[model samples]
Target: MPAPVPTPAPVPRQRDTSPAEGGPGTGSLYGQASLTLLVIEDDPAGGLTVPEILDVDGHRIRLRSARNLTEATRLLTPDVNCVLLDLALPHGATGSGSGSGSSDPVDPLAALRQVLRIAPRHAVLVLTSEEDAERAAEAVRVGAQDFLFRDELDGRLLSRAIRYAVERKRADIAQYKLAESKLRAQENARLERGLLPHPLLEGSDLRFAARYRPGRSRALLGGDFYDTVRTPDGTVHAMIGDVCGHGPDEAALGVELRIAWRALTLAGLCGDDLLATLQEVLEVERPNEEIFATLCTVDIAPDGRRAGLCLAGHPAPLISRPGRPARLLPYEDSGPALGLLPRARWPRRQVELGGSWSLMLYTDGLIEGRIGKGKERLGQDGMVEMINRHLDSGLSGEGLLEASVTEARRLNGGELTDDVAVVLLSRSEA
Candidate 1:
């Protein structure tokens, strides 16, 4: 049907002011658009088969009329948020595109898709002849928020259905976002546990203090891991390692490596042999070859002051003597990171500490923190300086680890954007 001859200077209708959508005022006047609506129909006369309806805020709607999909597309605007589309039209017909004038009859579903295309951002209500639940469901599935039958649709009922359709769409969107958040958290937790362990300190007198913080903000963990275990001989062995990447696969591989390290250490493996076997585990567990782990291991002697130190593609340990500044342990004979060099030899370096000295093992996360916004990183030397300042205040064990993490974050001026795992071992005159 041709559009009614345009009323030259037709008064732009006042928008419906209903209590529901919070328009200009309460719907005291007729023709107010509190529930401003547009009806797309085939009839030339402006009439709605809908009997009774209410908008979201319990306001009657001021209905606008559009004959067929052609006028409907032109009238679609933000002011008319809800659309009541007639589903009797034929297929593949919207008003736009070449040869899409009144001559081409449009399919109902295709017309819905086109009307949705035209008013892509609006909520839609589909109207069918009979109460066909299946067809109504399809309309809702095809993006119409609700469906109404021409026979049962009254002013009150139509109003309620339209309001419900708008609310349902908002609820669906919220639920999707919440589910996405939960899935992300679950994945992060799995990776984090692999990178940090509760430490097996059953038979040793040494106190173990460690802290791990992932570099990825809002992420559970990255690829850094640490473990501590005591041998039957009363010796305490501790290590901190970091794989090359910050992904879940790298983290899972890191967890496997740590577990293997603990088992081998309990079975009398140490230094090169333990690391060598770990490379085999890596080859089997890693998703690809590009991933590798840097490690720092320290074995405190039965008496505690003496220790065997090994660095495998990792930073050297830091030693802080009682009443003296802390400094890096010797890195004279360090090897490349595990999983990189098949024949790598991580030679053990033995060091003696006077009673009351402290040994700290940490991943590169601590030393690699950026000093400022620039590329300046707080390298090992900078870390040593920062530690000395913290030690001057006489902190130890968990207290010591907390102070170190705080200082690292403070120096970075925010949370360190890398996974940090630090383990500290101290011996007092016993």
Candidate 2:
């Protein structure tokens, strides 16, 4: 005895309509006025003609038929919105690629799966007999949008299923992309924090504060780097450097150089020997011979009253003491930048640091910004004047560095087109 087909849940008349097709008289600009369905069934001659199913807005749904997966592939066009695959279609007996005979009984959804593979982007609905209702539901679980029992299939029901499937697929794709974007953002942040150096000035009396800004858009790290550490002998070593470009590659090189500097310094290297070893590191790690880096390194004495200064074509450090205006350190005897000369000799000079003084070390990004829209740059002399003004206003330490960098960006009329890094070390006798 044949069992009666279970009636499907009622489908609403005014389903969400999109402008993917034309509706009744003329499709709305914002809403699809029509829909196109591709029906893949084994018997083309079988009386399976779709009845007239008009959308709520009077837009009519169009239908196309194919006897097998091969023919359906040829008719599948960009305009086809949904696919209706008949699950009863015959498959090859030997599990062959021809898909000629009845389907494999072990996997009754073989024919439906073939249709899905060919039209993966299109929404799909499986059509089966009422007796195979369980298999039809399984087809939906295998990625079909819905399933229809042959005995209860109606024009209105099919129309509603098509619209629902398409909308559901779009929502799924949007959700996937949003999640992917957030994951990428989190990974970049972790990578950046790991790459950027943290000050190693433990047990030192000098107050240290630093700031960095990348010139590249949407980037957290740049080609500017700095570090400070106190050696076993109580000599505080601080350095700031800049690579020659503005990109991730250059930023990566900057991090490498900063790390190498710390390793060598902690291992007891300083002055010309330290500078020479750093040049070797830059040469081996740089992407090309044309790549180079400017650096300024200072080793403060144990008493914090004197220091050894070495410059590799980098800007000089600024020093300001009580009862005197801020001034630029002597820079006339600096050596060529790293990776420039085969046997570059960076001469280290000794400078006296009076009691209660602040010293500023930075990269070219600090003083290279234009004074205004004009071509004139805020040269070393100009930077000296600017720092004197800030000192006159009673700003010191972090407040001083923040104000100076902000003023530089303002003078350039916008963000500087190069990476900026600033490090301030201040000693107080009071």
Candidate 3:
């Protein structure tokens, strides 16, 4: 004869209201709502008995019983918030993919693992005998939310455990999501920092300063890219370009183009050859055929008194001297932008730079901002005028770039709705 089944301890006559109902530090999953439990047990002979359970709100906790893993899976619905599994339940011939077909009969946690696999989102409580304390602890370690003793089964204890397990599961999921978000944010920050240019001007006397801002909200990088490097031939090479769109794919392509430009410039490629190869790269790496890039490059001589400028459908660089007003360099003979033509030629023009001067290369975003509420845009001419005003107040280098961007934003009435990149290279005789 089988041993007599232990009945649950008597519940109090009055409603038991605990902190689980409208408690502090509890999520939406908690409170007065009734919870449904799915119990997995092979109790055909009615030996194992579970008493009626009442939640903190005095409502009867709904219970659904399944004789085995197959039946449990069939009954495992989204409405079931918790699962109660009897660890001693026999792994019958019901092939529920719990590895019951294996020859090993000693694996006591196979049924528990199967229940966990099926009800991953549900809180699980493992029921075990007092003698199987080790296995009960192992069940909890194997992802069961909590463990219960068969002889100590009580309505109050079981209800409290169920609530605790559900809360814990919700907490675990929230923590996992928070950690995932934080990790993604950190990864994006590192990627943006890596993509930004780091000018190589160790030996050169040129003072380099740059400012970049992406139009997309909360974005660190955009379709605009730039780089400045002092080559082995004592020539300081500076290049700035803007991809067509302002999306992540465009930003990535800009990074690729920037890196390629750095590699090619360091390898002694310049002028039309460099721009042509860059066009080939854009044609291949761009997301679509309609995409293109506008670029401006300048190679300063060792003496810092002369420079070579090349424009590919990009704005001409603004030159500022001590006495002369700020003005744009020659852009009338500029070639088509990269990827716009099959075989375009970007002719490099030689420009004489005075002993003390500053050259500013920029993307179109700097001059495309709307002035006030009107549809009027701060075109290239307007940008030249703005620079002259800032220079009159003795602003130069980083200050000049900052003032220029801040005033443009003010003129637009808010943040500029385009990617802006400005690079300033200055040489002084002193």
List per-prediction Cα lDDT, in the order shown: 0.74, 0.81, 0.84
lDDT of 1 by residue, 60-175 (tens): 66677676677676666545657778775433334444444333454336667777777655668887767466877787888888888765656678777666655565566567
lDDT of 2 by residue, 1-430 (tens): 1232353332212233343433211222125546667777665445243457655456777677776676778777656677788777766422345542335556777777776777777778888888888888898888888888777767788777777776766666567789998998999889878887777778889999998889898888889999999999999999999999998889989999999999999999999999999999999999999999999999999899999999999989999999998888898889999999988999999999978999999888888999987999998899899999999999999999999999999999999988999999999977
**Sequence-dependent TM-score of model 2:** 0.76
Top TM-score hit: 3
What are the per-residue Cα lDDT tens digits for candidate 3 across 241-342?
A: 999999999998999999999999999999999999999999999999999999999999999999999999999999999999989897778999999999
Off by over 4 Å in 3: 1-34, 44-60, 97-104, 215-220, 323-325, 369-417
Question: What's the C-alpha lDDT at position 319 in model 3?
Answer: 98
Which scores better on TM-score, 1 or 3? 3
The estimated TM-scores of all candidates read 0.65, 0.76, 0.80
